[model samples]
Target: MSEEVAPHTHFQYADARHQAETALSGMWLFLASEVLFFGGLIVAWTFCRHWQPAGFDAGSRETVLWIGTVNLFLLISSSFVYSSGLAFMEAGNAKRLIQCCVATMAIGSLFLLLKFYEWHIDISEHLFPAGPFKINGADAGGARMFWSFYFVATALHAAHMIVGVGLVGWIALQARRGAFADGWLTPVEVIGLYWSFVDIVWIVLYPIIYLVGRE
Candidate 1:
């Protein structure tokens, strides 16, 4: 009989290792579903772009390139920070883990702030698809479609970042409470997976939203 190694190990888990594996597996399954959801959106966007190449190009040009680039770096940094925290937790350094979690949360929040600012700029430039669109040409309709996808994809990605920030905050609190001091870092690892997924989604969006048609 495998001895349960952690105080928080549930009854269903035979041991700490069992619990950690199950937790990671569950997170991966959840991420798979998320991939499909986002994948569909990407596919739909690709088809729309094919149908209205000029409009999509025009819409892409309207994006604030610097802002999107900065946000991409921020999200990538947050993922790195969170991974560092996880590494610290594995090394039995709870304090450093907490610090990393806090840092990750701060970075994620900054990304959200910048994203909102970018959206504000976009709206000011009449980029919103519903109201008065800024692009004027035969490709105006396609450009409007491009803006529509931009808003939807970016907005959805931002929403995921919001959730990720909250999760990081929670993990930080847990570390402060010594939840993973005994080396049972399952929760941290699980949340790390989620945070990484959010970062990846943004990575995919950054190019599609800001770079594709620029050349």
Candidate 2:
């Protein structure tokens, strides 16, 4: 019999294909947990929407619909940036990877700008939940409840965006130093998955928060 090929596995860094598959598997598992977490919010939203349909609808109308719509587009574009970034990193194009990171962060910043403006309008109208929550044109208490939920949920979403921006910044720095030049693109790919998941959360939030009451 021929000599056996002893287990050379210890000398090998993990199999690249196996590593990528594992990365994707872990990401999907994490995403599943995220879906469940957000699912609870949707359930609560449904209950409120059922109880106070008019109020919910009216509150949604009060929002600058165009603002939320534009933000949705911005996030979708950012997801593309992160996706392309992953492609570039995998293909060993460090410069392109950095470009992608910049683009993603820029788009995320645009979302925050629009969000801040929306908050400004709401606050100016004495429509903030904590203090003056008077809507001159609707059932004030219901409107207050509606805006209360709106403020809470969207604020949380914005905080997540902020965190995404920070993570992307760190990714950018790593790319600049040729950190991903070798077969070490795993971290970048995993973080991109996280960024996309964050974007997906907002995708669901946008419609529920802004489209529920629209005619």
Candidate 3:
């Protein structure tokens, strides 16, 4: 494989291996904090659900299961595409790496669009907690609380996806400029780790929010 000149900033590192290790470590440290943040929310939701089983189920049943499932599929597909991009980077195939990055971004954007549509439907159905929320045949207060957690959790997750999509697009542009050449693909790998974490968080959130009461 051909080697391009390393950037001056990278000169601080002894070699590409060390630089990549440091970058990945930094990303994991950041994600650890995110884990704690989201974990708190999950714990709180678990307590609420345990306290109000009937209302939570009624609220969960009201969710559009198909949309949630589709969103999950899209997120997982994006992660796969991103992993492929990482492999392409390892093989020094910049062209294929760029393609994978763009594909991942497109998949992530579609997930966000579907999310907005789902939120619109919820708003129309009087599901927004701030509004006069309505869930027929469920304890109104408990149902309101359920929707409150639902919107807050999903909205935060969607925001993270939007950020991830933008990061992937930026990486694609950089790849087009040949910045990831010469095994200097640490940035791409770091971004992939962050994106994967976001995807995993959603995977956990989905079952709690959508599949909890579907028995």
Candidate 4:
């Protein structure tokens, strides 16, 4: 129990600590469910790779490594910046929070741009598994499966990034208006959690999608 304050913006609970705990718990629950969903994709990837290691490796080699590497750098850095925004919020520095949020969104958008560019390169190279895939021979099917998994996983990740960008922008707008001061920092904290989750998924994906076949 703590001193009761008037109902804040998002949290109706008067106890500040209770509100923080509730928000954190809710975010963890949501992220846990997301982890389960992504876990299925990883399981599928494992099975497919086990079945056709050569094909999987071959498909991995065809991917443009540099772009993926760059995107990973951008996303990881953006998450760090977003974390700083959360720190700023905790310190009651709305100005820094807004700046960090905007920077996070910009970096995330750059990652998405680079990702799409790589996808475009993939298309140009005829790596897309659109039935008549260029990855010919007996191992072609396995290679196609690998590419399919790659597309699905990356697409889902990009969608999540897009949503994160929007959320950061919204938080920035709110912060600009002084809406997040006086202990109303739940939104910043929870959104940073989400952004960090997305970055972690990409961290896992980067090695799987880029490093596996190189060896």
Candidate 5:
């Protein structure tokens, strides 16, 4: 019986293990940059909220709480499912790995669907901070600012979710083709890191968008 050979390492790497470590390190660096980007947005939001607490609170109150909460759960669940897929790959269970990837994709898709619906509702209610805006108060200008931040932040996060869903689907297709059977699971691990990072971003955004100023 011949032992299975791992996937070929790129010429730039010393070996398969070296290649994997390099890939992981690259992902971490990418995510670190992402952190700074999102952190800037968060800081901007905090400053705006502090300046217009009433308006921020009103804008937050208009958000669809149930949809945001449910989407949060979906993202969290998708992350778990993707991680389970990684574990299955490590265990050499290609079938289960494929199943988990598909599940994660489905969950991510549902989250996007719900988010779109929520956006539709917000638009219809004139919550978009544009012409015919619904939020009017002593601090209507502040409220408009809040809605601007809301749209920008949530739209960015949703874009990330869209990418994550596509990646998970791709991973599923690759797993079905037995691409990771030889223990060359670097792709799976890297995608997992990306997916988890996106989920964590939403986790941070959830409270700021939904729970924080609603009281």
Candidate 6:
């Protein structure tokens, strides 16, 4: 029950607290699973790169550094959209809240499409990690390793982008329903948490995979 709720109210204090706790606890558990998924990739990458440092370094050098940098900035800007959305939701401004979600989705779509182009260019240049590679030398194998992780991590991140678009759609629906008037903004808050978590993962990936071995 709400604190200001009347004595005759059907909802009780324990129920309200339980609901809040359950929401936060669920988010935390999901985050823990995300950590394990990415953490395992990082570990595998570390061992492989360590075993073939020269090849890994060469692969990293071949990366289009500027593109990675630009994408990082793009994603960072999208995080601001989430921040603004959270603010608008709390303030009960339905227009601004929906606007923020749409803005974030637009930016995210741009990021993913640009990423697709980047991957295409790499493939055209024979930078892929597997069979029929045209790049000369043993570094080909190493280059393949880098591309392997590149595809895996970025593809995983792109999946999150799809999920974000869905969240924005749902939020648009809620805003249309006039739900925030009741201060029922918890769903918005939870989706924001998930979106930001994905953003944070990319922030870490950007430096390690793109910038770490720069000349």
Q: Would you estimate the TM-scores of all the predictions? A: 0.96, 0.86, 0.93, 0.94, 0.95, 0.89
Q: What is the alpha-carbon lDDT for the whole of candidate 1?
A: 0.91
lDDT of each: 0.91, 0.81, 0.88, 0.89, 0.90, 0.79
lDDT of 1 by residue, 1-215 (tens): 45444587877878878888999999999999999999999999999999889889988999999999999999898899999988878889999999999899899999999999999999999999997779887979999999989999989998898898898999999999988878788899999999999999999988999999999
Sort order, TM-score high to low: 1, 5, 4, 3, 6, 2
Give the poorly placed runs of model 2, Cα more than 4 Å off: 1-20, 136-138
- Comparing 2 with 4 on lDDT, the higher-scoring candidate is 4
Candidate 4 per-residue lDDT over residues 1-215, each given as its tens digit: 34346546233675767878898899999999999989999999999899999999889989999999898899889999999888878888999999999899899999999999999999888889985687899879888988999999999999999999999999999898888877678888889899999999999999999998788
Residue 194 miss distance in model 4 (angstroms):
0.1
Residue 82 shift from truth in candidate 6, angstroms: 1.3
Off by over 4 Å in 5: 1-6
Residue-wise C-alpha lDDT for candidate 5, range 1-215, written one tens digit per residue: 23323355766666899889999999999999999999999999999899889888888888999999999999998898889889988999999999998899889889989999999999999998989899776868888888899899999998988888898889889888878879999889999999999999999999999999888
Q: Which numbered prediction scores highest in lDDT against the true structure?
A: 1
Q: What is the lDDT, from 0 to 100, of the residue 157 in candidate 6?
A: 82
Write candidate 2's Cα lDDT for 1-215 as tens digits: 23323221122336666656777789889889878877877788788778877777767778878899999999999999888988977888889989999999999999999999999998887768677565655556566778888888888788889988998999999889877777577678778888888888888888888877788
Q: Is 3 or 6 the stronger prediction by TM-score? A: 3
Q: After superposition, how far is residue 150 of candidate 2 from its true place, in Å?
A: 0.9
Candidate rank order under lDDT: 1, 5, 4, 3, 2, 6
Clashing pairs in 5: none
Higher lDDT: candidate 3 or 4? 4
Instruction: Rate residue 189 of model 4 by lDDT.
Output: 87
TM-score of 3: 0.93
Please report the TM-score between candidate 6 and the true structure.
0.89
